[model samples]
Target chain A: MLTKRIIPCLDIKDNRVVKGIKFLGLRDAGDPVEVARIYEEQLADELVFLDITASYENRKTLVNLVEEIAQNIFMPFTVGGGIRDSNDIRELLNAGADKVSINTQAVKCPDLITESSRKFGSQCIVVAIDAKKENDGWQVYINGGRTPVDLNAVEWAKKANELGAGEILLTSMDYDGTKDGYDLELTKNVVEAVSIPVIASGGAGKLEHFYDCFSQTGASACLAASLFHYQEYTIKQVKDFLKGKGVSVRQ
Target chain B: MIAIIDYGMGNIHSVQKALEHFGAKTVVTNNPKDIETSDKAILPGVGAFDDAMSELKKQKLIAALNKHIRQKKTFLGICLGMQLLLQNSEEANKSDGLGILEGEVRRFLDRKGFAVPHMGWNQLKIKNKNCPLLKDTPDNSYVYFCHSYYPQPKDKNIIAAVTDYGVDFTSILWQDNIYGVQFHPEKSQQTGLKILENFVNLC
Candidate 1:
């Protein structure tokens, strides 16, 4: 039986894990390896590390961080945020990333998705879409949800699937940092549109929010950052809550 | 010592890291002598089948591996590495496998409502509970999987476990000193680590 996955995402900036990731397990906010171990202890099925650092020099640090975290933990993890081409994907996978999520570059040149998936298996390529509700439908957002692309969320997801993307990471721009809840309508649209696994990101204020996204939409995995980072809710708590609701989770 | 065969294919770093976590001495090399000398060997692979087989041939590790397996040496194969143990694969046009196991690697059909790559965590239904790799693990344990194709063995007795995507496909295959898992044990979290630990201890 395939179980729904709970993923905790860590955003790395300047070669350090950003956000106040203060925890009993972590020595500091910048310790990606320590933070990753704690999440694994909490039984996170998978992890996603976003390298928000844009400089070439800092990329070396991010690569090193990925290697350290991969060494420390045994679960699959994805690296995203500023991946440009197939070569970039190869470098990170060599460093031990299970998958690479591409957003801006994918929208700029859709061929990047095809090429990356072709070179590396589709299982290693994930296309992330940061979407915001526009006049009538959801429009894709890029550059950390600052710039809006003239693409529909559902259409873009469908196109990504056609291009051989293994999975779709759909983050709702409106729900991000709001801590309200996920855009179920948007998530449902993308999930229904794509044949691959869809990871619902952003929002996730409460435990029920994770359950709501899983039960309401066809998302195979749900991702949260601040909630888990702040220690408000552990991955175990969320999995137990979902398990109570009769949702299949790795318990 | 354990040898991780480096066939110029996928990254074997994570596999090495996982084995090292268990305090096992490991080496990543294409040299056949190293593999033959080690108590255990792991064939870690990713990407296309033809390319991987070509690289193994180029390095002249295929014949060495065949001899090592014939000697009943402890061997483990992971993901594409596991698939390569079969007779042939449908990937990369058409390619012949090592023929160590009598089977063919077939692609997954695009069934309605089922993903092709079969990415994410799924439960393993143990077929042969006596298999050493299933030791210390539950009957239906969740393991990570990422592949568009799976192995179809000619001899079903070698299959230790199976997972259902659209069909009941083989997840783990074992016979004597040889073992293979379709999923990435290095990426399957604690359950994965336990599997690796079991393999390491088999020596």
Candidate 2:
């Protein structure tokens, strides 16, 4: 049986690990390679490195950083942000990233998901959805969560999966940075809506939050940045807590 | 040298890195001569069976791989590579495979409710206690996996280990000189590295 995964997300800017609170107020955490190495040693099931930088030059630096981390670390790592086309996804995969997450571009071109999934396998195509609670339902946000699209979060998730997205990285804007907990309602709805694995992101503040997300939702994985970047809890600590709660977690 | 057969399929860099990390000299190549000259060969693949087979044929690696395996050479196939060792796969419009192993690749829908692509880490239930590749690796050890289909080998004797998602399927296959795994050892972390080390030290 597949064990629940504990992933530490690294938000990268200019080749450095940066943490953004509610998608704002950037703070340096550490070097991408160094922080990735630590997460691997801490037994993080997987690592996610989102190249938060928008410039073409910074994207190159992120690729270089990905190579450095891949050379030093052995676990599966995902690279996201600024992935515009299949070529970008290929470049990152060739650079040693195990998977590539597409958010803004996937929304613009759902065929990009189909094309990439066909070129590469669906195993490597991760579609990330940044969603904020709107009215009674969640609305999809793009362009670093600054723009709200007309698509509904649940509806878009279903569409993304139908378009050949292997996994869904669902982030609840309402709960991001506040760390109250993952938006369980949104996560559960998304998980039920999609057949593929759903990774519950944003609003993970405490160890119990991890347990709650896993136990409450059908999420295959839980990802956090500040909780891990700030060193409030190590990956080991989170896993230990989950294991104690009778959740099947990889050791 | 351990040659990682890269027939324009999946990323072989991580596999190369893992082997070299354990002090094994390795090369990722598609050249028939390079594959033929290596002491052992590792076939790592990703993507559909039809495309993988076409690429292997395009690169002229199909013959080289079969010849090497015919002489009882050491070999390991990961994910799509492992599925290719089977007779055929249900994926990619029921494409034919290498026929190295006597079996048909089936999808996970046979057992409902489980995810189609069995992604993330899973435990191994040892079936072949004496399999060299799993020498030090404990039973039920966690290994990373990402695939929609699992091999249902015809001959049960060749099975080395099995993992259950919705159905009990072959996770590891070993027959004489050829070996294959449905999971990615390179991505399985410590236990995965240990399996690669065991494969590296295999006599």
Candidate 3:
């Protein structure tokens, strides 16, 4: 059976791991490689490194960091943030990243999704959608949730799947960093909207939150940052809880 | 030394890195000469079946790989590399594969809730505990997988292990000198590393 994935997202800024509440007021976490090794030890199903580095010039550091992490960690990991074109995707994959997540570039040129997927295979292309609940539905946000777009969340997810994206990293900007819980409704809508696997992201506070997202939304995976970063709950603890709850988790 | 055949299909770095982690010397090459000279070779790929077959042909790796396997040298295929070992695939257009294994690659049917790609960690039920590739690997151990199409071997005796999603599919296959895994052992963490190590330690 394909078990529900438990991912630990390491938001990178200036090559250092950081976590922010609602994508603001970032706090230092630790070194990327070191934190990654710790997660690997904790039996993390996968690791997501979101390079929040601001300057395009510093992007080379991310590639170097990815190579270093790949050398040390044997588990599958994803590199995202500031990935603009096919070249970026190729560079990351060559550097040993199993997948590359694209945000703003995907919206700016939706063709990137199709082109990259065609070139590198859809399994390696992940479209990260940052969404916030609006009027009657949710609107998509890009540029690390700083800019709002006219696209609807569910529609964008379906469009991304149609555009050849293998997976959707759906993060709720409203629930992000709140430590409340996942946006079950938004996740469920998107999961139902697309046939590709949907990774539910943002607002993972407790063990039950992880269970809730899996049970309520049928998400293929759940990604958390601060909850695991601060050592409030270990991945083993979460997986154990889920296992006890009859959730099919990789133990 | 192990040669990882790279036909420009997908990433081969992780495969090389994982093997090297087990202290196995590896070279990533598209040249047939490298593959021919290596004692063991790994065909690691990701992408559509036809594209991979075309790339392998363009690189002239088909004859070299078949020669390597015919010579009774150990050969392993990962993901699309595994699919390419079969007779043909039903992806895109009906296309021929390497024909080394008597099987056809088919896409997963659109079940009610099962995803097509069948991504993430899944347990393996080892059928052949004597297979060297699964030497120390325990039954029901989890491994990483990401693919929409899976190979259905005509010879069931060649299947060494199987995994379930919506159906029980051949996750690992072994014959005399050729082995193929639908999962990415390099990216499957510890159990994956163990399998890679087993391959590396094969004499």
Candidate 4:
């Protein structure tokens, strides 16, 4: 049986971690490699590093950071944020990233998904969808969730899978930062829409939230940022809690 | 020194980095001479079987790999690299593999609940505890996997370990001098690292 994954997402800006990590006995919390090492120590299943740098010139820094992190950490990690073309994906993968997530580019030019997936393998292409509930349907958002697209979240997920994306990282804009819980309906819809793995993201406040998303939505993985960044719950604690709940988690 | 084969298919860097972490000197190369000269070699790959086979042929590594194995030198294959060890794969249009091992790569059936690709961490049911590659790797230890196709060996005795998704598939393959793992040991955290360490220490 494949175990559910617990991923700790780290936002990167200009080669450094954006969100403050409050891990104890750490020299530099903003360092992506250091923070990733801490999560690796906790036995986190995987890590996602989203490069949120605004400028285009900082892309080189992101590549350098990925190389440094990959050299040090042994666990699988995904790098996303400004992935535009196949070259970007190639550079990152050559730097030792296991997967690369694409967002706005995927929506702006969906052919990128097809081309990159074919050039590289579909297993390394992840389509990150930032969605917000609109009326009864969830609408896809791009440009870091500041702009809305006409694509439906569930439909987009299916299209991404069709476009050869290996996985779907579905994040709910409404539930993010609130820590209320995961967007179960949206996640469930996307999970059902695609045959590939669905990683439920955003609004992971408590241990139950992770369980709820996995148990209720049939999500293959759950990703949290502030919940783990604040040291509220370690990854081991979350996995242990899920284990007690009869959820098959990687221990 | 270990030779990490770079056939321009998948992420060979991660494999090299993991081996280096265990203090194992590694050289990433596509040249047949490098692979033939090395005491041990690792074939780490991702992507479709047809493409990988073509790339390996384009780089002229198939014969070198066979020579290395025929010499009784240790060899390990990871992910698609593992699949390429078999005789053929059902991926794409059903292409031929290296034929080093008597097996066929089959895609995971579309079961009702089970997802395709069988991605994520899965536990290993170790059948041969005596296998040196599994040293310090406990039974039911979790390892990272990402693939739609898995190898079904004709000789069950060669299977050292198995992992269950919708079906029990061979996750670890071992014979006299050749070894293969369907999982990405470099990305499987401690258990994966332990396996890599054992492979590195295997003389």
Candidate 5:
């Protein structure tokens, strides 16, 4: 059966696994390889690493850091941030990434999505749409949610899917750090807009949020950062809770 | 010493790195003489089955490998490397395999809500307790796998470990001196590395 996945996203900056991952027993948590090893031991369903430094460094993608993380991680993972074109996607995938996540680049050159899928297959392409509440409606945010783009969330998801995006990663900035709960309304809307599997990201406080998102939003997976970074919730706990809710998970 | 057969299919660099981490002298070779002279051979591959086998046949090392097995030179195949050691694969349709093991590769059919390509970590259930390669592996331990078509063995004795994916399927195989892991040990965290280390330390 197609089980609901529990993913722990790692945000990389300056070739390190962001400062937020300072969990206990993981003194060198900022190291991508070390943090990845911990997550692998806990049996994370998959992992997603976003490189936030390359944009400032004017570098293409973090190939060196990718090589480091890929050494420790065994399951499928998606790498995103500063992925400009097919060449960048090719390099990351060649370095052992399962899929490439496109946000800013897809908005800049929508054709890159089509080109990437043609070269590396659609299953290797994922479109991550970071969104925030705008006047009672969700608006898309680009450039790591720093720049707000005047695009409707549902419309953006529909367009990205039409362009050959295999999956949609819908993240709500409103609840991102709050840990209130997933934006179920936004998740369900995007899920309805596209035929591809949608992974709901951001705003996961407790195990119930994960269970709620899977049931209400119909999202194939849920990705959390702070929750996992603090060791507040383990992937096994989330999976077991989802299983109790009658949602299928890997045993 | 481990000689990894590199015939344009595997990302031999990572495999080479992993084996060396265990302090094993690993050699990446496409030369038939290397396999003939090496103490043991490792077949590591990624990408499609037909492409990998074409490289093997193109290099004309298939006969050399058969002789190596007959001589009991220990062999290990990883991921698509293991799949290529089977009879045939349905991927790319009508592709001929090395026929080292009796089986055909086929896709995972869904009864309902099943994902294609079964790509993630899955727990392995040990079937044959006497298999030496499975030493120290915990029961129901998870291993990484990323393939659409899995090997279907004609002889049940060849089965080593099986994983349940909608339905139960063979996850590991051992026939005489030949050992194959469908999951990527080089990628599979500690449990996987321990298995690879066990293979390296085997007599």
Candidate 6:
């Protein structure tokens, strides 16, 4: 059975793990490696490190940091941000990063997805589509939720899957940092539309929210940052709750 | 000395780093001279079977590998690297393998809605009760898995461990000095690193 995964996302800027409210107003979390170690000890199913600025930066420190994590922690984790070409993807994976996520670069040159997937294999490629609701329709956002993309959310997911993206990380910008819950409608909409695994991100406030998102939306996994960062809930506690709710967590 | 064969397949650096992490003197090499002189050889591959074979043949590393394997040297294969040790793969078409181990690779047909590439952590069912590779690893412990095809060994003596995805499938195979893991030991965290350490300390 496909176990429902819980991943703690570390947003790296310059090299440190930081989080912001609604994609703005940054706050320091802690050492990236220490935080990662905590999550691993808590039995986190996986970890996601996004160089929120990987695409914009001249050079990325996330790859080095990810290598540090890979040296100690052994569970599979995906590194997103600034994966522009096959070489970048190959570098990250070769560095012990299990998977690499692509956003703006993938949209601008869709060939990145197909080429990376073809060269390295699809399971190693992830297409993370950042979206927000606008006038009853989801609009895709790129460049760390700073740029608006022309492709439709569902359509882009289909294209990515067709291009050999094994997983889709759909994030709701509107609900992000709100602590209300996920944009169920949007998450469900995209999950139903794609055969590939969908990870619902943004606006995960409480344990029930995870249950609600997984039960109602049928997402393969739920990803959160703020909650885990602030110690709002330990992953084990949340997984225990979800397991009680009959969700298959990697126990 | 561990020579990680770099055939332009997947990430060889990480594999080397992991080996070096365990204090193994490792060299990432494609040259036959380097491999022949190394104490052990590790084949790390990612991508289609046919292309990996083509790359090995194109670079003439297969003959070097055959010579080394015939000398009873330690060889470790990872992911597609592991699958390539078998007879052939059903990924795209029938492709020849290194044949260092007795097995054939086949796509994992869908079972209970399991995706094609069985990604993420899954438990391993060890067959050889005294398998040294699984020393500290727990029974049914969740090891990272990312692949579509599993090795079907012709000889049960080589079966080190099995993992259940659809039905029971081969997760790890060890024959004489040749060892192959479908899961990345370098990526499996503690358990994975332990396997690598054991391989390094192999007598």
DockQ of each: 0.69, 0.66, 0.74, 0.74, 0.19, 0.46
Candidate 5 error regions (>4 Å): A1-4, A25-29, A55-61, A72-76, A84-90, A93-99, A103-178, A185-198, A215-220, A231-251, B7-14, B57-64
**Candidate 6 structure quality by residue, lDDT tens digits, A1-251:** 45788988988877777773222122324567667777778888789988865644534466677777776675778888777778788778876787888888889999888888877788888899999887868999988899997778988998898888888999999999998998899988887777677889999998899999988998878999989877788899899999999987777
User: What's every prediction's RMSD, in angstroms?
Assistant: 1.7, 2.9, 2.9, 1.2, 4.2, 3.5
Instruction: Write model 5 residue lDDT over A152-201, tens digit each, in one string.
Output: 88899889878877788899999888889999999988887776678899
lDDT of 1: 0.88
- Tens-place lDDT per residue, model 3, A21-60, is 2221223236787788788888899999988884688778
Comparing chain B with the reference, what is the TM-score for each candidate? 0.98, 0.96, 0.98, 0.98, 0.95, 0.96
- The per-model lDDT (C-alpha) reads 0.88, 0.87, 0.89, 0.91, 0.80, 0.82
lDDT of 5 by residue, B37-122 (tens): 88889997766676677778889889889888889989998877888888888774546888999988777784333444465567
Higher-scoring candidate on TM-score, 1 or 4: 4
| Among all candidates shown, the one with the greatest TM-score | 4
Candidate 2, which CAPRI tier? Answer: medium
lDDT of 2 by residue, B43-77 (tens): 99877788898898889998889988987889998
Candidate 2 error regions (>4 Å): A20-29, B110-113
Estimate TM-scores for all models: 0.96, 0.96, 0.96, 0.98, 0.79, 0.89
The regions of model 3 sitting more than 4 angstroms off are A20-29, B92-95
> How would you encode candidate 1's per-residue C-alpha lDDT over A178-222 as one tens digit per residue?
988888999988888878889999899999999999989878899
TM-score of chain A of 4: 0.99
Cα lDDT, model 5, residue A26: 83
The TM-score of candidate 5 is 0.79
Please give the clash total of every predicted structure, in order.
Answer: 0, 0, 0, 0, 0, 1
Per-residue lDDT of model 4, residues A1-251, tens digit only: 89999999999888888888998999998899999999999999899999887467987888888889888898889999888888899888988898999999999999999998877778889999999999989999999999998999999999999989999999999999999999999999998888999999999998999999998998999999999999999999999999999999877
Per-residue error for A180 in candidate 1, Å, reads 2.2
| Residues B59-137 of candidate 6: C-alpha lDDT, one tens digit per residue | 9998899888889998888888888888877774545898878778988775434655777777878888667778877
DockQ score for candidate 1? 0.69
